[model samples]
Target: MALYKTIGAFLLFLGTVSGYANPGACSGTCVNTHDPSIIRRSDGTYFRFSTGGKIAVHTAPDITGPWTYKGAALPAGSSIDLGGNQDLWAPEVALVGNTYYLYYSVSKFGVQDSAIGVATSSSLDVGTWKDLGSTGIRSSSGKPYNAIDPNLINADGTYYITFGSFWKDIHQVAMKNPPKAVASGSSAVQVAFDPVKTDEEGAFVFKHGSYYYLFFSKGKCCGYDTSRPAAGEEYKILVCRSTSATGGYKDKSGKACTNGGGTVVLESHGNVYGPGGQGVYDDPVHGPVSIRSRKTIWLIMLIIFALQILYYHYVNTKIGFADGQKQFGWNTINFSSGWPVV
Candidate 1:
C-alpha cells in the first residue's frame, strides 16, 4: 500500500516533472486493485483504498476515473483476530490532520501471522471507517520484517512507516500513538534490502528534491495459478535513493540498498506484465486551470500538485492474476533523470 505526504505547497512542486503525456488508460472502478491506497478528500472526493472486499472502497471525481463502487473499509471485518480476518492486506491511506488513517494488512499468505491495523476517517464516506484494531505492527516466524506492504511517509516532520514482506526486506518505524503505533522504544530500521533476493516488497517513500525515493516490489508476487516466475522473474519495479528518511539507500551505481542496490523503475514491458505496486503524489488544484483537453486528461487529476503519479499493478498476458484480475496502472513521472522514469 502507498500513502503520501510532501505538501508544503508541494515542496517546490516535488522538484521536477516535465512533458507529462501519459498517465492514461484509466476508467471506471479501475479494475480490482490490490494493495492500492489513494487519498484526496478536502471535498473533491477520490478515495480508493484497496486489497479485497474488507478494505475495498472506491470513489472518484476525477483522477482520470469514473470509479464509483464505495463499500467496505472494514464493513464488519478485521477486529484483528487474524487468519485472513475477512481478507485484508495492504491498504495504507493517509491524511493525518483532519484524520483519515486507514492502515491495514493482517496476513495469511505465507504466514508470519502478521498484524498492522488501524482505521479512521472524518469523512471518507463509505460508512466512515473506524476499525482501529491494532497498529502494534507485528510479525512472527523469526521476524526480521514481514508485517506486510505498508508505506506511509512524512519525513522531516517525522511520521515514517515503511513496512515489509519476504522476511528481512524493508522496514522502518517511528510513528507513535496518535501518529499510529510502533514507536515506544522503537526498533525497525532496515529501510530496503534484497541481499540477493530477500525479494523486496511494496515499500514507497518519496521526498523528491533532497532525495528519499525508495519504491520497492520485486520477484514473485502472486501465484499465477501455480507457476510463473522467470521471464524477467515475476513482479518488477525497483528504485533506491536516500538522504536519510531512515536509511542510506542508493542506486544509479552508488549501490547500497542494503547491498542489493536497485534501479529498474518498472519492468516487464509490453502490455505491462508484473509491474510493481508503486506510488507518488502531487495532485491538488482547487480552481481554474486547464490542460487543453484530450477530453481533459481527466484534468491532470485536478491539476496542481504536479500529479506526478506513479500508481501501479499490472498483469495482462490477456488478463492475468491467472485471470482473476489485478490491474490498475498509471504513470506521469519524469523526474528529469534525477531518477523516476515513466
Candidate 2:
C-alpha cells in the first residue's frame, strides 16, 4: 500500500509540474517589493508583507491586484538591537491556532549578526501586532549558517522554521506553539544547501499527497543592477520533496537536497528577473498557491483553480466515469444507444 501511494504521488508531481508556465506576474502596486510574503485573510483580502521599514504591508481584493499599500506590520521596528539601521527583511506570515504569526528578519547588511523575530496578532492588521521578541535563532562569526530569511511552516502536528542565507544555505528548527520560540532542546538541522554552497534562502515547505516539498531560491538574489550580474547569478527557485517533513528531500532526478539537488521551479523569464524570497499560502478558494517576488511580484493566484478542476476530471475519468456518470447508478442511462431515460 505504501509503495502504491508513493508511486501515485510521484506520478502526480511529474504530471503537475510538466511544462508548467511561468506564473502570471503582476506589477503596478505589487512591484518593487523586497522579500515579499502574501497571505489571504478570512474575509478574502489578500495581504502582502515585505522587507522594508516596519515591514511594509499591501492589500488587494484579489490575487492579481492593484495592491494598495495598507500599512506596516511592525511600525516601530524590532525591540532587539538590530545593529541600528532599524529595518526588517523577509516577512513570513502564517496563521496557526487562532493567532497570526508574522516572522521577520532583523539584521545589518552583509553581516552574520541577525535574529528572526516574531510578532503576534489575533487580527492580522497593522498596529494590532504585539512584539513577541526573537525566536532565539541567531547567527554570528564562525557559524555554518547565517540566521536570516525566516519561513514558518506548520507540518503534521509540529511547527518548524526554515531560515538562513548564503554560508551554509538553509536550515530548519522545530517551534513551540504560538510560534514565538524554538522548542526546547530541539537542535537545528540543515535541510537544503546550494550546489555551489552559497546563496540559498527563503525556504518554504509544505506537504502534498504523501510527500513534503521544500522550495528555496538560489543564486545572486538582490542584484537588481542587471548590467553587472555574474554568469548564472540570476536567482531562481527550485524544489525537492521527501516523505518526512524533517529531512531526506530529493528532487525529480532523485538527487538528495542535502547534496544541493533540486528541480528548477522558476527562473528569469521575460521581465521577471532574480525571482526569489517566496512563500506559499493554502488559499481556501485556490488550494495551495506558491507566491514569489522578483523584479515584479508574481501572485500566481487562481491558476490553480483550473488545475483543481482538471484534477477532478482526471480522477473521475480514471475510475471509468468518463461521461461524468458512475457505471453503477441509474443516472448512467444510455443515450447514444437508445432513448434517454426519463
Per-residue lDDT for 284-323 in model 1, tens only? 4322245663255435433432436777767666665652
CA lDDT of 318 in candidate 1? 62
The residue pairs in collision within model 1 are none
Candidate 1 ranges beyond 4 A from true positions: 1-47, 50-56, 64-69, 73-89, 92-104, 107-112, 115-139, 150-167, 171-191, 194-238, 241-250, 260-332
lDDT string for model 2 (1-342, tens) is 565445445444543565333344343374446676778788888777877768978787865566788788888888976673278888888888788889988887789988889999987888899987789998889888888888887786788999988888889999887679999999789998866667778788865557677878887665343243565576666778888888998888888888879877655544334555665545444443444321322223222221220000010122321222211100011111111110
lDDT for residue 39 in candidate 2, whole number 0-100: 80
lDDT of 1 at 251: 88
Cα error, candidate 1, residue 61 (Å): 2.3
After superposition on all CA atoms, what RMSD does each candidate show versus the true structure? 19.5, 13.9
Q: What's the lDDT for residue 108 in model 2? A: 76
